[model samples]
Target: MQTAASKAPAFRAASMALPVGILTLITLMVLPIPAVMLDVFFVLNIALSVAVLMAAMNAMKPLDFSSFPSVLLFATLLRLALNVASTRVVLVSGHEGAGAAGDVIESFGQFLVGGNFAVGIFVFVILLIINMIVITKGAGRVSEVSARFTLDALPGKQMAIDSDIAAGLMTSDEAKARRAEVATEADFYGAMDGASKFVKGDAIAALLILAVNIIAGFCLGMISHGLTAAEAAESYITLAVGDALVAQVPALLLSIAAAVIVTRVTDKSDLAGHIGGQFSDPRSWMPVAVVMGALGMIPAMPQSVFLPAAAIAGYLAWHLKKRAAQPEPVAEAPPVSPDRITMEDVSDRTLITIEMGYGLVHLVDKAKGAPLVARITGVRRQLSQTFGFIVPQFRVRDSLDIDANAYRVLLGGVHIGGATIRNARVLAIDIGDVREGHAIEGEPTFDPSFGCPALWIEESERDHATAEGFLTVDPSTVIATHLDQLLSRRPDALLGPEEVRALLDTVKEDSPGLIEAIHPDPLSLSKLTRVLRALLADGISLAHPLPVLSSLALALQQTQDFEALIDRVRIDMGGWIVGKICPYGEVLPVVTLDARLESAILQGMRDPATGQPIIEPDLAGMIGERLARISADLAQRDTPANTPALVVQPPARRALNALVRARAPDCVVMALAELPTSQAVEVIAVIGAEEEQAEPQNARQEELAA
Candidate 1:
């Protein structure tokens, strides 16, 4: 058992480590210290500097020694404080001898400088120059540059982390840790940049203190003690030089430590390990061994030194060569029994995947600050909001089988779409009306998202391309835009039963009673999913969940037929539909069917048996062709290819919508009953006429006979 007496010293030492150390430094600066106490403090200063150097050398990375800057500050202060204490002791007692200041200083003066005051002065100045001019200056410069670059690259690093998180490659906890490490690295380098100034100032202060002590000691010695001028000079200058050397040596050690740390890369291994591994190759040693051996044989050279050095290099070269020649041992795999194979061996396929060729792999490389990952995250977020469900995480991977510049978007292991992108070039998409001559010379291709013509130009030509009225985008944006378009077109395929339940659970919070009133009775969750999928299939948004839920609940109570229920819900969602098609205070651009064609379509939908319209092939074919033509014309007139509304009577709306969806899916087919009264209509084009249907009818009959 430990007694109180045994633990008291350890406890006191632990408790006094910071506060007492600071107080002692303050006391040493303020009051004169005796030679013996000064000697002890000087020794402590040297030991602290050595400890700092060893710690710096052993650190695996800069962040591992994050407190180094503060440690450097404290060490510099301790040395300066010791300088003051020793300066006072030396100036007051230098009339006696070189040993007047302290044993540490006295020994440095007599033993290190051989008791010559001039030699001590010369050595002190040399150490001061090395610390102030070379090591400290270089370290300070490295710290400044590191801090600036770290701060400049902070945003890119943070973006990379967020992209990794969005890509599901990093967990939230891992991202948080990485962000903290980045912040610590920036702070450490910034502190070092400031802390380096302390070392420089300490060196200058040592010089000033030495000069003061020597000059003051000489005057006091001659005036008060009645000593000769030469004797006074010798005694005072010797102690002063010793004091300067004692302080400067530790300053030099710390300066070296600072340089080592600031210049160190964030490698996994320590300095020694890194150096040993780098120099391990026999090829590198062989050249040095040969050069040393040749030098050892030269006439008039110091063979005693050179031969041994050559011999050591030769031995290192031979040892390294033999080690390189040895075969690497491989571990044997454990035996597997066929009967023990399980389903766990098979990997499940991802719902969505973006596979790129080798050349385009940099678009997902975190080190390169790839913007594609972040852009894809934004696309997913926007699609989720528009489609009323969370899009699955996209898996980005590389494939060697694809073309070097090509990337494929895969949905459920099937290739949906792909595009070729130049990693070092920007795609300038022409938005119509760009003259051929004005555009720069480059590889011309169609934009993958919409098939608009685009030019692949060097990054430096981006400004010129933009000035020529082309929209400039990087490879990442091009891929993300293409993916967005593909996802937008296939919203129905993305929504499943899980997304349906999520939607219900989300809306239940706002109207819990309403959600409870309509489930499993009038409408099952499966039926609701189908209805929602139908709405999303036609470019409708489900952002307003409460309204959608309320509409669904109201419609389900009146009809058991899923088709009729969806139509009622669409009618109930007129305000939202109208708002999406036509902005507030703007008239809706609509295409109306010719009177005769409208009547035929109504007659076709009069079947009471299946609730599905079965039109004649000729009439259906004619209507599809006319609608597609009208949609194309309207798209050309609109700036961004706005969806043209095909207005019809409420009875024929469902039949007409089905007809148009099969042909021109981009057109919006709205019923007269579904149009919001607040919005006005502008008839832009007419869809069909009697004469237009006649030719298709005759051709269809001929084809059938054939």
Candidate 2:
């Protein structure tokens, strides 16, 4: 239903509002005749010329004259040369109404010598000062505009596509294809934007010249064409104005309009900054044209209009100067300490020693690089009792089969043990081809059922000693063992006294600084505990949590980044901590130790009525009982303050009951560890909901009792 005439009223309303305001202001301002007569016209002419040169140069290529004195000097020299040349050209061409260049030169000399020159010179100096102020003030406008333009030019479609990809709303391939299409659009827009700059540059120049001519033509027509401002007010006044409201107003308005429009368009694009990267962009040239036009119009405008034009130019320059003075914002990140050796820094040799067991060494030798190894049957038994293993222990009487190709150590020629095979630590390796299941896989496929069988060793000076103690070979004690004979000859021959002292000194110096920087303060325990609970909820294991939690606690205590600590914790604990934990607080523990001791009582001897020293008495039963009691006491001492606590939260805990029902419909084991028999029974009752669900039916009761 909208018509062309309907839009007409809106357009006219916008056009008239500005002119009316200008007119009203002009009428209110009253000036003295003599004050205006102080060679004001000449001063304005000079100011306009200066503005023209500056704007033109700026648009040609953004000027950075503030920091570099040479650039400013070069510009000044060019301006002076151009001014002189213009004067000479006008006089030679007879455009100045002079027969010779000498006459024009003489006139210039006369003006300089005469009183008007002093006033003009003073005004020109004032103009220069004002221009300098403006230059320093508005420099940031270019950067600001450039920033806006950059954001605007970014393809919105691409941004959306990226968001969708991040939010898991789109397939990876689709996102990539869409991003490529978005890039194509950006390139097209960029090309058009470059062309706009040149157009803008030229248009600004034309506008300035037009303004000067309009003012000159109006004055000329009023004085000599018998067309005064009063009668020439009706049509669009392309000439200077005097008394008639429309005549003077529109001409001035048009000139200001042209300048303002150029300023705005150039600002939005920030062509000034772009000039460094792309001199071909049209916006770069627009400022140059504006500058040139202003310079040419210097001698043409009336004092009243010309003065204001000069003032505006000066203001613009000030803005540039202020912007130049502003500083940029900088992002500060958390500081990292260089003192700590993380899990990654642990040595391969150290890890192997810890995993294989360490107390069976007989001797060590470094003279010929031989490491002698011995196995103790008693220690192997002790290890088996303390830490449960499905495979036979390394024995002093047997040789260990070392699978170097697979980076695995095997006992009984079947049970593979070690971190190198499961972890990504075999940096230098070779894979052989095979058609069967034994073929080496180049990249291990992700398996949810697979767990990392890697061991993390702490950095310490005791690795060598520990390694010496653990290599055993007793046919019954170990399935196999390899003793490095050269290393077994002499352990003291590894490093001399001086080298050992130096190593000790270095450690001494670094240890304190490292501890100060990496160890968590006791005061941050509460915060660390909260973070630990959060990690637990995210499925991190209790056995592995301490190391990660320590790292986080240290980072927090040292006032380091919380986010960085979180990220570090994630890295150390594996990405699983980023996921959810199931009910019953039942995240699987990384590893568990069996601390039970078995009895070793001797069998009965012959009954001969002789009592004293007849046979070795059996003490194994008593020893076993005492050992069991000792273990129990130790466990009680290690018990947490809130142990046997129930996790009764609704959905999270209930899920455990459901899972247990599905997995072990008849098996029941209370969630809490190391509880008294009575307490454990109570826990079973709660988990099974005995009162309502009935006591755990057969197998469940047996598991609870066990």
Candidate 3:
């Protein structure tokens, strides 16, 4: 508290400095001053100009010295005010000789021009021409051109920053800072463009002040003091030139500073270091040395100078090359430490991540936790319960890499699926429920999840669409639904060693003995992880792990082989699997291939690695088409939950699973041996009886219904 109080007055005074300085400049222009005061003000003016020039030259980039333009403005005003005061003193006391204005002005008149007024007048004009015509004019043009280019490219630089953000290469705060820098750079250049005019005008004003002092002083010296023409001209002309010279020196310094500031390029170091590092390249110096050597050999050339310069250049080139060739020392990497970042430092720890475009960002209401985010949280909770393990927390981030209205789901940084949506519009999906040729008008699109026809319509039209029998879903629902569908298909993708370990840890609290039968005794954590993932792949959830674990323990009693163990586990869980489709009392709908077709497929091309026969693509396609027809027929029979199961020979079940997965994902493929004795089977279709056979999915309808 005491420190803050101490700083308050000093800080307030610093903030008031500019306004106070302006008032002082005004006072200098309006009031008269003694010769001593005039000399002190003159010295301060020159010091300010030199300081500004040093600051400009030392800046590595233009923006590093962003205050240069404002400094130039005040510095120009100070010079102009000094000119006004000096002109007054010179005119009023012309008969008093060279020191009439000040010691500084007197030094310029007598010492600088050797007591000659003719030479002093000529030298002052020359300085004025250089400041106005050369340095100030060039700096003005550079600043003007730079300002125009910076403004033109502003939009593009902002877009590039946005691109990096969308690509997940940079975060939001980095993007914000980058945008601020680009705006500041443009503003700096624009100010420099106007500030250059101040320097140019200052040069012109200095010339005019000299003219007034000389003309008025010359007349006043003779008319008021009874002086001769030679004496008046010597005294008046010399003093006028001296005062002008005093102002022009600083004006020229300021012009050079402006030029230096505008021309700077961004670099890691100050201007001197940047230029020095660039010239350190050996290839650049070698050429310079060779060119100098060639020029020195000419008889008309100045060998005395060129020969020595060439030798020096060659030596520098050799030194630079030696330095370049020296191998860089490898710095030892710091030992990995704890508590900073580790794996948790990664913002996205979720195995699953949703990246949204800028347009869809509004769907996530930060204060209310966003509608889409809420939906995703619900989906994750549902999936975690269904899978019987806590799914990792998901991350939702804004990305500019994708379409403004689109979003994508990434599983381990790999894009799974993405689609565009109307920001706040509802999606009217045609789920084969709408009437033919309905009058509902909207932007036509496809459902990202199901590939069904959908329309993007205004929220007001949602009620109308729903009334017309179309399923109306909001944009949040659309994205959430799409993500849910894609993730649900591959639940096994979400389970890793960590999730498996967590699952086993939970199981241990209840049945440590049961876990012991199938875990470390027969399977390690990695092996157990694979076994559980395989069960998940078979559509069996760990939600109720006891039945799955109980079945696994029984399977291990017969065989320790991975494939044989999986097969045994399926057979042991036969009753539980059939109960999902038939509900213990209901009759189960079964599909099978004819004797010859089954034999052909069972005896088809065998996999060299697994020895399971691979089904032919044409034969597989025919079976899939037939099964899809039967599945559709059963869907309308008020028994959609009892999706039909195909019972196949044990040896052929593994071979046929992939084909069914692709063709009829809803149909379950089961081995006949895996079926329970109490379950009743009604063969819905003999796939090859009429034409082609059934599709591939999985053994037992239990996985399908899970």
The model with the greatest lDDT is 3
Give the alpha carbon lDDT tens digit for every residue of 64-113 in model 2.
21112222222223222322333223222322222222332334423433
Per-residue CA lDDT of model 3 for 535-624, tens digit only, reads 777667788899999998988888878888878888988887777677667878988877779999877789899988888788889989
User: Where does candidate 3 clash, by residue pair?
Assistant: 166-400, 166-401, 365-370, 388-543, 623-693, 660-696, 660-697, 669-698, 669-699, 670-699
Could you tell me the C-alpha RMSD of candidate 2 in Å?
Answer: 26.4
What TM-score would candidate 3 get against the native? 0.51
Q: Which one wins by TM-score: 2 or 3?
A: 3
Ranking by lDDT: 3, 1, 2
In candidate 2, position 655 carries an lDDT of 30
**TM-score of every prediction relative to native:** 0.49, 0.21, 0.51
Candidate that scores best on TM-score? 3
The clash number for model 2 is 67
Q: Which residue runs of candidate 3 sit more than 4 Å off their true CA positions?
A: 1-4, 157-172, 290-304, 329-341, 344-706
User: Which model, 1 or 2, shows the larger TM-score?
Assistant: 1
Write model 1 residue lDDT over 509-592, tens digit each, in one string. Answer: 877888787765555878778888887775567777778878878887788676677778888888788777667777667766
